[model samples]
Target: MSKNGSHFKVLFRPKAETFRGGCGECQTSCQSACKTSCTVGNQSCER
Candidate 1:
């Protein structure tokens, strides 16, 4: 269980970094729409 948890954390670390970096820009460009899409798992801005 611990091993799986560690692997999952590692797998998502880059995504977290990308989100931190891109989220600001997304918010600047799209405002509330970006936040809504992100929370809803749309990931349209991730492209």
Candidate 2:
């Protein structure tokens, strides 16, 4: 989280598998699935 309340660290907590959000552990109704590693705080992230 940043100074303001509009920022958050996008933690791509991969499940038992090696993928990020393709496994069943991902949010059941994830609307923002399979996106880049960037977050509100991270404008850019490595591939």
Candidate 3:
């Protein structure tokens, strides 16, 4: 039997999935909508 708490267990997870790459009109619209562009492609080359 395991004694791990639910709250603690909830925090553990596998690698987060990357955003779907869509460099179309929809993506452009979303970028414009956001106050600060947070997407990786727009900001830097590393990731």
**lDDT by residue (tens digit), candidate 3, 2-30:** 38644444556545443444334342444
TM-score of 3: 0.17
- Give the winner by TM-score: 1 or 2: 1
Model 1 alpha-carbon miss at residue 1, Å? 4.0
Better of 2 and 3 by lDDT: 3
Top-scoring candidate (TM-score): 1
> Which numbered prediction scores highest in lDDT against the true structure?
1
Global lDDT of each candidate: 0.50, 0.42, 0.44
Q: Which of 1 and 3 is the better model by lDDT? A: 1
**What RMSD, rounded to one decimal, does every model reach?**
6.7, 12.7, 8.2
lDDT by residue for model 2 (1-47), tens: 66676576766865654443243453333234336333433232222
Clashes of 1: 0
Error of 1 at 43 (Å): 2.1
**Whole-model lDDT, model 2:** 0.42
Clashes of each: 0, 0, 0
Estimate the overall C-alpha local distance difference test score of candidate 3.
Answer: 0.44
Ranking by TM-score, best first? 1, 3, 2
Candidate 1 — what's its lDDT?
0.50
